[model samples]
Target: MEDKRNIQIIEWEHLDKKKFYVFGVAMTMMIRVSVYPFTLIRTRLQVQKGKSLYHGTFDAFIKILRADGVTGLYRGFLVNTFTLISGQCYVTTYELTRKFVADYSQSNTVKSLVAGGSASLVAQSITVPIDVVSQHLMMQRKGERMGRFQVRGSPEGRGVVAFGQTKDIIRQILRADGLRGFYRGYVASLLTYIPNSAVWWPFYHFYAEQISYLCPTECPHIVFQAVSGPLAAATASVLTNPMDVIRTRVQVEGKSSIILTFRQLMAEEGPWGLMKGLSARIISATPSSIVIVVGYESLKKLSLRPELVDSRHCYQRFTDCYKRLYQLQPEMTQRIYDKFITQLQTSVREEISEIKAEGNLEAVLNALDKIVEDRKDQEEPAWRPSGNPEADLRSALVPYFRQQRDALQRHVRKQEAENRRLAEAVVAGRQQVQELQRRGQARQQAWQALHREQKELVAVLGEPE
Candidate 1:
C-alpha cells in the first residue's frame, strides 16, 4: 500500500509539471499582449534621437496618440504579436533542449550556458525577419508634418510632395525594394537578440539559486524571486545594451543591408554611434525585464496551482496574492493586487512614523535630504553648452568668479587712484596753510622790527622795554 501511494504521488507530480507548462504558455501570451503598447513605445523611443521622439518615453507616447490617435500606439502590434508568438516557440523548444542537455551534462553551469546560448541562436535565426519588420512597424508613423495619407519612404517625387500612410509606405517598399527591403535589418536583429536572450535565463537561474542559498529557508519565495530577476536582468542589460542599440537603429532606418548600415553609422561617428540610445535602453530594459520575468514566473507558478491563492491571508495574499487560473478576469486580479500593494506601502510608511520618535525622525530626514542632494548633483552633467537658451540666459546674468576677479582688479585700481589723488590734495592744502603761517610770522617780525626801530629812536628820546 505504501509503495503504491509513493508511485501515485510521483505520477501526480509529473502530471502537475506538464499542466504547469501549458498554463504558463497561455499566461505569458496574455502578459505580452497586455504590455505590447509599452514595448512599442520603448522601442521607438530608443531608436529616434534628435527628433521629438527622443524627448522621453511619456512625451513620445503622448505625441503618438495626438498625432495618430489610439491606433498609432499599437502601430506594429500585429507583427509584434505574431513575432512574439513565433519566438515563444523557440523558447519552449529551447527549454526542452536545455532540460535534455542539463540531464545529460556533468557540470550544471556548463549545461546552463550551452543550453541558453544554443537556444538563443536557434530562436533568433528563426524569427530575425519578423523581429526586424516588427521593429520597423513600431517606428513607422506619418512624420508629424505629413498628412494622414502621406507615406513614409515614398518614391522620389517633386519638391515637398506629401508622403503617404504606413500601409502606403509598406506598399511602396514592396513595389520599390520587394521582400528584401522589409527584412533589411534581419542580420543585425539576429546578431543582437540571440546572445542577449541566451545569457538571460542562465544568469537568472544562477543568481536565483545564489540568493535562495543566502536566504533562510523560511524566507519568502516572492522576495528572492523578485530580487534575483532584477539583478539578473540588470547584468544582462549592461552586457548586451550596445547590440540592442544597433538592432534598434537598423530596424528603424530600414536600410537595404546590415553591412551598408554598419558602414554608414561607423563612417558617420565611429563605433560609438551604434550606442546612441544605450542610456535610455538600459534604463527601460533593466527594470522592465525584471518586472516582466518576475511577473511571468509568479504567474507561471500560480497557473500551475490555482488552489494556492488564498484571499483571507492579510498581507501575503491581499497585497501579493494573484489569482492563478481565473478565466473571468486575470487583469482585474492584477489591478486588485497592485492596489493592495499601494495601500500596504502607505501603511508601512505610516507605521514607521508611528514607531519612531519625532525628534529622531527630523535628524534622519535631514540626513536623507543631504544624501538626495548629493546624488542629484552627481547625476546632473558637469556642463551644458552655452548655446543652449537656458545656459545662455544663466551665463549672461550670473558673473563667473573669473569675471568677478577681473572686476575686483579694476575696482582696486580706481580706489587706489582716488586714494592717491586725495592724499596729494591733502598734502597741497597743508603746504598752503604752512606757507600762509610762515608769511604771517614774517610780516609780524617785520612789524616788530619797525616798532623796535621806532622804540630805539624813541629810547634815545625815552622808550622802555
Candidate 2:
C-alpha cells in the first residue's frame, strides 16, 4: 500500500559523501563511455561545411566505421573520460547550491534552475579545456573530407601518429594559438551548457511532477524520473543546439569568436546550419540523460545514511495515513491534517533527539501521548455540530478517527502479546541455566564421594602390603 506521492527525496545532508562520490564517478564514467560515439558523430556533423560529408546520423556512423573502424567512433574517449573530475565538481556544486536555495524558495523549479546554472558555471572551468582537446581529437579522421575542408596528417605523414598522441595535440595547439588555445570556446561553452543545465533541470522536475500526478498511485517514482529525463534533455538539446554548434566549431576549427562563427555559419550554410547536428545531439543526449538521471537517483538511495533510511520509511507511512485522512473530508480534514502533521513532526524530531541522548523509551511514549492530547484539544471545537445537519463534517471525520483508534488499539494489543512472549522466553532461559548448574554440582559431589571411597579402600589394604 505504498503511495507514489510519498516518495522522499534524499537531500545533501542525508548522504554518505564517500559512497556518493565513488558511485557517482563510476556511474558517470560508464554513461559517458556508452554515449561517446554519438558525441563524436555530433561534433563531426557540427563542424562540416556545405555539401555535407555524411547524409545523416546513421550514414555518419557507417562511413566512420568503414573508413577508420570502431576506433573512429571513440576518437576522443581518453580526453573525454578526464572530464569525470569536472563531473564531480558539478554534482557537488549542484547539491550544495540546491540545499542553500531551498531555504529561501519553495518552488522546486526555481531551486533546480539556479542550482543547475551555478553548477555548470563552476564545472566549465575544468571542462572547457578538456572539451577543447577532446573535440579536436574527435575531428581527426583519416581521409575525411567535407567540401573544401580536409583533415591534416602528421609531419611524419601518418594520421594515426599525428592524432594518437595527446602531447602532439598540446604542442600543436601551443604552437598555433598559445595557452589560450586550450580554452578556445570558453564563452560559447558557458553559453551553451549553463543554459542547457538551467533549462534541463527545471523541465525535468516539471515533467516528473506532471507525469507522477497523471500516472496511477502504484507507479514508482523512478519510472516517472526515467520518462522525464530524456524528454527534458531532448528539449534542452534542441533549444541550446546553436550555441553547442558554435562552441564545437570554435574549439575544433579555431574560429576567432562566437559571433564570427555564427556569421560565417549563416553566410556559408544558411539558417538550417544552426541545427546541423541536431539529430545526433538528440540521439546521444536521450539515452545519456536517462542513464545519468536513473544512476543519480539510485546513487542517492544507496548513499542515504542507515538511520535516515528508516526515518524515510516512517515518514512515508505517516504520509500515507495523512493522505487517507485528507480524502475523508477534503476541506476540513486538510486543515486538521496539516496542523497535526506539523506538530507531530516537531514533537517526533525532539523526541528522537532526546532518545538518542538519553536512551529513554519513556520519553518517546510521553511525547506521543502529549501530541495526541494536544491534537484532541485543538480538534475538539471542530468536532462540534455545525449549523447544517446534512452537510456535517463530523460524520465524515468520526469514522476515520474511530478506525484509526481501533487500529492503534490492535497494534498495542499485538505489542503486549509480543512482550509477554519475550518475557516467558527470558524466564525459561534462566530456568535452563539453573538446571545445568544443579547438575554440575551433583556431578562434583559424586566425584568427591568416589575419591573418598578409593582412599578408604587403600587404607584398608594396609599400605600396599
Candidate 3:
C-alpha cells in the first residue's frame, strides 16, 4: 500500500463547499451533543464557590445524577448547541485566513496560529451571547432539596431556577442587565478561547508531524489525528484553564470586570482556583478535538472534486509502480496498462481524432511496430502482449521501466548498507555491556573480601581479654 502521508492535503479550494458545510455542521452537532455533559460539568465546577456542591468532575457527575437524574447532566445543552453556527463560521474563517496567509509565510505553524486566532475572534461574536445564556442555565439547580448548588456570581438571587427554562433565564438577564447581559463575559471569552485556538492548531499540526515521522510509514491518517488531537487540546486546555475559569465566572455570575474576577477568585480560592475546572475541560476537549479534527479531514476527503480524486489515485499508482517493478506481476502490469490507456483516452481524445483525420495513424502504428521489433531480443518477456493500444503502449515504455528499475536498485542497496551498519553497532553495544558486567563482578568480589577481613579484625580485637 502507498504511504498516505505522501498524498496531498485536501485544501479548501479542492473541496465542494456545499458538501463541506453540510457535513461539517452535522458533525459539529453530533460531537457537541456527545461532549456537552463535560462542558456543563466544567462550568459548574468553575462557578461553584469552594467546592460547595461538587468536589470534582466525577463527584459532580454522581451528585448531579443522584440529585436531578440523567437530565441534570444535559442542562443548558439546547442553548449551547446553537454554537454550531459559530463553529461553521470558525472553520470557514480558519481556512480562508490560512489560504490568505500562505502567500506571505511559508511556515505551517505560523499559518495555523494566525488562522486559528482569526477564526476564534470571528466565532466569539456569535458564541459569547450563547455562552452567557447557556452557562446561566448550566448553573440552574432542579433538585435543591439534596444540596443547594451555590454559584458565586449568579444573578438569580439564592433561589433555584428550573431546568430547561431558557426563556426565564433570558427574561431575568434582560430585566436585570438589559441587552448587555447577553455579552456579560465577551472579553473574557475572547481572552480564553482566542489563545486556546491559536495555541491548539499549531500544537496539533506540530505533534501530528512529529508523530507521523516517528510512526511506521504505513500508519493510517486517522490514527495519527486521534493521537495528536487530544494531546494538543490537553495542552491548550491546561494553559488557558485560568482564563476559562474567569470566563465561566463572568458569564454565569454576571461579573462586570475580568480583572475584578481574577483578583476576587485569587483572594477567595487562592492560585489553585484558576484550575477549578481543568480536569473537566481536558476530558471534554479530548474527544471533541478528536472528533473535530477527524471529521473535518474526512469531510474534506469526501467532498473533493472528481478530478482531484482521480489525480490522487494516479499519484498512488505512480508510487505503487516501484513495488510492482520488483515483483513483475502480470496482473499488476495489466492494471497499469489499463490505467494508462484510460488516462490517455481521457486526456487526448481530440488529439487522437486529429491524428486519425490527418492520416498519421498508420505511420504511428509502424513506428510502434519498429520499436517492438528492436526490443524483441533484449530480454525474456514477463507477459505476451495482446494486439491492443494498451499492450503496444506498454511495450513502447521500456525506457521508463529501466529508469524506475535503476532507482529501485539504488534504494535497496542503501537500505542494505544501513542494515549492516545497525548490525555492527548492536554487536559493539553487546560487548560494552559484557565488559561492564565483568567490572561490576570484580567490584562486588573485592567488597565482600574487605568485609570479611574487617569482621576478623574486629573479632580478634574484642576477644574478652
Candidate 4:
C-alpha cells in the first residue's frame, strides 16, 4: 500500500537484477504471444504480391483458418518465444544505462538516445535469428505444395510448416543454409531496430510531454502515455517501414542475399517497393508499443514497493542526490532537512505545558519521540532503519528541542519563586499596617483618657471660676 512514487532513490546494489530480468521478459512474452495471431496475419498480408493472397486482413484470417486451422495462425510460436531473451536484454540494458546516464546529465533526450541505442544494439544481436525464423513460420503454409496452389497463391512460396516444435524448424533452417542462415538479415534487422528504437523513445517522450502540457491539470498521467505511445510508434513505423520490408524479405527462406533482395525489390517494384507493408506495420506496431510501455510502467509500480527497495540503500541515494546537486549548484543546500528540524521543534514546543511538565524528563522525552515520527515523512528517512540522518538529527536536536520544555519549566519555576517573595512581602506589609493602626487606636484612646482626666481636673479647679 506504500506509495512507490515517493520512493525517491534506489541503489543499484540493492536491486535484484536477475529477478526483474526474468519478470520483465516473461511478462512481455505473455503479452506478445497473446497477440501473435494478429502479427502472423499482418505478415501474411504484407508478403503477398499484386492482387495479394487474400482481399483484406479479415479475409486473409479466414483463408488461413480454413486452410490451416487454429495452430496455423500461431505458426512460429515456439521460435518466437526465443525472442523473450532479446526482450529481457533490451529492458535490462535500457534500465541500467538510462539510470547511469540520468545521474550524469538531467536531459531526458540524451538519456533516451543512449539507452535506446545501446539496448537495441544488444537485443538485435540476440534476436535477429529468432526474427528470421519467426517470420518464416508466419509466412509458412500448412499443406505441402504440389505446384497446384496457384488456385490460391504462389506454390513455391511455402511448404508444409511443422508447428509446435521449434527444434524442427531450427534443423530445417540448418539443413537448407547452415550457420550463416540464422543471421540471414542481421544487418537489415539492426538497421530496422536500432535507429527506429533510438528515435521512437525520444519521440514518445517528446509527445508525452507535449500532450501533458496541452492537457488540463486534472488530466491523468496514463492519458499522456496512451496518446503519445501510438502516435510515436506510427511515426517510427512509417520512417522505418522500408527497412522492415527489406529485413523480412531477406529473412525469408529461399530469398536472395540482403543486397540482391534489395535490388530485386527495386527492379521489380520500383522505389516504393521497400515500403510494401507500411499500413500493416503501423496497424500492428502501434498497439504493441502502447501495450508494452503502459504495461511495463504499471508492473514497475507494483513491483518497486517502498518496502522492497530496502530503505537502507535508499538513504545513500537520497544523500547522493544532494551531494551531486550541490556540487553542480553550489548555492543550494539541504533546506528540507533543516525544515524537518524546525517542524520538530515547533511540535515539541506546543506540547510543553505546566500540566505536562514534571520533575522527570519523561514528558519532554516523549515529546521528542513524537517529533521524530511526525517529521519522518517530510524528511523521508529510511523505511527500515539504515543509519538514516533522521536518527542522527534526533540525537543532535533532542537537546535543542528539549530547550523549549526546559525554558518553559524555568519560567514556571521563576514565577513560583517570585510569587513566594511577593507573598512574604505582602504579609510583612499587612503586619506593619496592622501595627500602625493599633498604635493609632492606642494613641486615640490615651488622648480620650487624658481628655477625660483633664475634664475631671477642670471640674476640681472649677471653684476658682
Q: Once model 1 is optimally superposed onto the true structure by TM-score, how far is the C-alpha of residue 306 displaced, in angstroms?
A: 13
Best-matching candidate per TM-score: 2
Candidate 4: tens digits of C-alpha lDDT, residues 1-465: 211111232323335665556567767877776667777876665556533466666777798788877877787787789888888788778878988996687565787789888999999999988876777667667443211111122354343354433565567778878888889878888898998888898888778778877877566666777888889998888888778877776776456577887787788778877766666567667667777568666556445645565444443354454454434532222334445546766876765654366554686678768988788778554342336556654554476568778999999999999999999999999999999999999999999999999999989988774
Q: How close is candidate 2 to the true structure, as a TM-score?
A: 0.69
For model 2, the stretches where C-alpha displacement exceeds 4 angstroms are 143-164, 324-465
Note the Cα lDDT for every prediction shown. Answer: 0.58, 0.80, 0.79, 0.69
For model 4, what is the alpha-carbon lDDT of residue 124? Answer: 94
Tens digits of lDDT, candidate 2, 205-238: 7788799889997787778889999999999998
Evaluated at residue 45, the lDDT of candidate 4 is: 55
Error of 3 at 376 (Å): 24
User: Cα deviation in Å at residue 185, candidate 4?
Assistant: 0.2
What range of 10 consecutive residues in model 4 has the weakest lDDT sum? 145-154
Over the full model, what C-alpha lDDT does candidate 1 score relative to the true structure? 0.58
* Ranking 1 against 4 by TM-score, winner: 4
* Per-residue lDDT over 46-156 for candidate 3, one digit per residue giving the tens place of the 0 to 100 score: 988897888899999998788667777887787888998999899899989989997897566888899899999999999998988887777767523221123332244
